[model samples]
Target: MRQYLILLLLFTLVQSAVTDSPRRPNSNPPKGFVTTKGSKFVLDGKPFYFVGTNSYWVPLLTTKEDVESTFKQMKNAGVKVLRTWGFNAINGSELAAARNSDLTYYQVWNSTEWVLNDGPQGLQRLDNVIAMAGKYNIKIILTFTNNWVGYGGSELYVNWIGGAGSTHDVFYTHPKIIASYQRYVKTIVNRYKTSPNIFAWELMNEARCLGDLPGGPSCIPGSGTLYHWYNQQANFVRSLDPYHLITTGGEGHFYWKKPVGFWYNGQFISDYNFNGQAGEDFDRDLTLENIDFGTYHIYPQYWYPQLDTPGSNFTLKAWGIDWIKLHAKAAKRVGKPVILEEFGVTGLENKTDIYPAWVDSALSTGHGIMPWQFGALGLTENGGNRVIKYADALINGASPNDGHAFYENQTTVWNVFTNAAKVQDAKSK
Candidate 1:
């Protein structure tokens, strides 16, 4: 009788252990690393749906204290992921002539070779940003380069190899340029390959056939040039770091179909998004073996300025919702989770009125949403008096204000994000 009772107690405890734990049997990801299962993101064996935000200036900030404050404010608003620039290249000539010695840069191109800046005001700044994000329990998506010229993008590479007259698209196919990019990528990937705080390595920001400059004769859109480049770089990063996720960081343009039209306000416009002129095929790119998920951005005002006017046949709100639905449908077909990675409106009222509906659609469709940018309040000295202003407004001592930033001071817009984050958290369970 005594032996029977002891065996029965042991069996009950085993059952309870199996039932109470959230982890699935035979499923384990590296501690704190996020992995995907089917159409959902899995972290520690459970589905992980989240609300995140972007702040490209975080790594370029001058101090660790500022970085910590940025992460803390984001955590307070329920941001689980952050996206920032990982590459900042400058020509050695430009560096030598620059008036600001305090500026941060990751790579420099000399006459014969490329030099990586890993000291203070360089990669070390990125190191601090990552460390603070880890301390605050947030993950980061580091974008390797930009399609635009804001922070030394593909154009810079072309300049390094072909001088002033070279075309922008060669950055994708030029053998020497590709090798230089690979060298930089390998260095960054190996440095933090073991860190669990990295959510993904973004290949580039808004990659298109045309960048700050015109494309060459060979830079044909819908020609699979960008697609091939993405595949090569993604495979290279994976070889260096198998733990982190990868994404194209394109604006989610599609080339499979051509010239789809949509009503904007009162007039009909050909949807350039569906046209292959951007050298992006949303569906095709997501199908890449190493590409983990899909990402799309919504900025109706920028994409269709006509829609911003009153009395339109279709409203921006309606168009944005449809955009979300379309991408969600695509994710289902591809069998991977997709994120509405960056989106925003110009007005606070527009955001307050439209964001909730979009968030609801994202939640119902099992998609994650991250606003274009997150803003925080910070203090600075002005003539011996302390002044409070948006931290982003102080970047490089000037605001890049694309008019999409939202902050804690903006209670209504801020609530929409915070509440949606809570709802996403609840649904993840």
Candidate 2:
């Protein structure tokens, strides 16, 4: 759904005991991390790039040892930021507090959710996580909900109970929904308004525009739902927190008309416009008045040449640099900061790794990127979409370096970021 920040700052006191050198992001965030209009942010004063990963879900209500490892890994890899989700279990405290009318994302088998209520713990919990993240010098592109709350898939609906009654997607028509969202935002912005580590406010991860559910056309707002959620979420975030950057972590918003929110109906450029080969890739003009940054989620599902069997040959794997370039260029052309939020060559057998040089080329533009994921804990016969073993190797219990994709020369993505940051720094002067 979105990328996660796999980083942890567990070695702070120990490091301080040995040496007083500060960390990259935490040591005192550079002025560049701040958001200012006209000259909002400059990588070394010039356009900068943000490279990071995503944690599919965060169990704010409960703690997990593995979660910390992911963030630690990203930081070790020099990943600057993390695209993370604000958890809200379909059946969590927030929804229980909502009691009945609200929707919480408790449908999935083994997914964690983080939602808030009218109490101090929820708000305090977020602040605590944010503070911990600050220790690693990691900024977060935080999303309010998950992808299980909408449609029949994984989305973060506030009151979703995931029953027959709650199967249908919840709409903004509910006042409680809007109020809950606002309350969460107010809590976050009011508390961290001055914090430099918070990167941006991602409205929702992969708000879809579906003509119908994967099965049929009975989905509410199926075709028309995309625009509804996009506009509403934009207005909602702006009304609550307008200071930082705002974006929807959709699959590919460069040309895809709608972003995450509805999960209604949509098609990749080629499939929808041109018969699966190539299409009229015009900018959808999605830069809503409230949005400051441009964002997209690219997982090779649509772009991969042999999508179904991309894993058949890692060499042929699709989540490569060329795809990032095309998508970034499209976003840049649209006049907004480009972000590759959800993407990774995450497959069981076909794990096609993105090499570093390819990363160097893609990040040459110095744009921000959040690699699709941080860890995939356990795969229950997944459709080869996620690789649990890789995530397992990427996770750990004590040490913090577990969540990073370690094979740099092999994977090459880690190098992509370092190389880009170097170039961006050189240009800053």
Candidate 3:
């Protein structure tokens, strides 16, 4: 009888352990400006959809007057949602040109102290942004950090913890750095927890555990580590901010294999290496319970094969459409909304139809879409390629007006985007 009791006790222990493990929880509040009902965004108890843009560099890179002008342009274009960076904390010399010491939302005063200032230079700028967004009735998706080195994100954390020249994974594992990150997170969340202008709190701009060094991109650690980091940070953020939604802010590059029904040409998957891009795991990360929504970016020129190749414009367009459907289906399966948060192409040629195509897909099946960037200013940082370069420009209060302006003579594209917004507004009403 004692032996039988021991066996039963073992079984009970096993069952209890399994039951105690956390599962992905759904993050749908009943009534709010940014709640979710299943896979649809519910604003004021009505289904909400948006056509948005990334004025990510505005908080620090542009002057207060420039911020007003740019947001005015966005409002005129009917951009309902504006995504911006909430965190830019990088110091030291290697990539100093893009380091804005004054504008960093969170600063490391010394090795052990992080000065999370809300004064003129720190969180006040974001405060001003939130106020500006409210003026135009625009909701904001504020991202915390970048995964890459340009803006002193994961690399900065790694260096601060004495892991200089190490991979970004260290930032997740290092006790001291993680503590510092938590402090920063608590500070920001507590500061803006009551603000209604924020639509969501993006955990990171693009959270990846890329083992990139100072020079270039290198290998990645085990893919599972990235997912674990996302889960931890996301849950932490949700715990702090009860009012706002949360998302991982991944580039929508899938780490999972193509689904059985999804059609893909060799060039589509091979030219850009989607699976390993930024070392992301979309299938796992997006479906997490605390993650209120899923986001992906579509940058064909940077990721797809050349137009002259066999992939061709038609194939490219088809792939883009399929990518949207695939992720939308994934979100639906998990009962969450998805957004094509970033999409763009460059050149003198007109690509007005590109935004419309993606926007249509998003509205009909998904939640919404945001163009790569919008605002009066051109890509002023890092020669207009990466947003991380905004840090350097902010520190020196310099605006490098590169030629990558999304608002320059963009009448056709703007009309398509705003037209969609008008439809969404009608539905909400």
Best by lDDT: 1
Off by over 4 Å in 1: 1-28, 96-101, 262-269, 379-400
- Measured against the true structure, the TM-scores of the candidates, in listed sequence, are 0.87, 0.61, 0.79
lDDT of 1 at 353: 90
Q: Record all residue pairs in model 1 with backbone atoms less than 3 Å apart, i.e. clashing.
A: 265-312, 265-313
| Candidate 2 per-residue lDDT over residues 1-429, each given as its tens digit | 122222234455443332232111122335635452331244334544456666534333223233454455566666677776564443433344433322223222222233334233344445555766777877777776544442123333323423233322343334455455555555656666566677877765555432122212322322434444555666655554435566665555333444322111254323332121111122442445555566665445554444344335434334356556766676566555666565555443233344343455555655665655554332222221322221321122222123333344334444555555565445445
Candidate 3 minimal-lDDT segment of 10 residues: 394-403
> How good is model 3 by TM-score?
0.79
Comparing candidate 2 with candidate 3, which one achieves the higher lDDT? 3
Model 2 gets an lDDT of 0.47
Best by TM-score: 1
Candidate 2 minimal-lDDT segment of 10 residues: 273-282
Per-residue lDDT value at 117 in model 1: 91
Return the TM-score for candidate 2, rounded to 2 decimals: 0.61
Per-residue CA lDDT of model 3 for 1-429, tens digit only, reads 999999999987764443333444334543435877888887876778778888666776434675676677788887888998878664534224433433444454345445555666666778888889889889999887777765446667776674546666677666687667777777778877777788998877766655354322333423466676677777677666656888888887666454322225443334233455556767777766678889988765655444535534455556677788888888888888888888766652435645567678878884777877663644334333343344323222233333233654666765777788887777676
Ordering by lDDT: 1, 3, 2
lDDT of each: 0.80, 0.47, 0.67
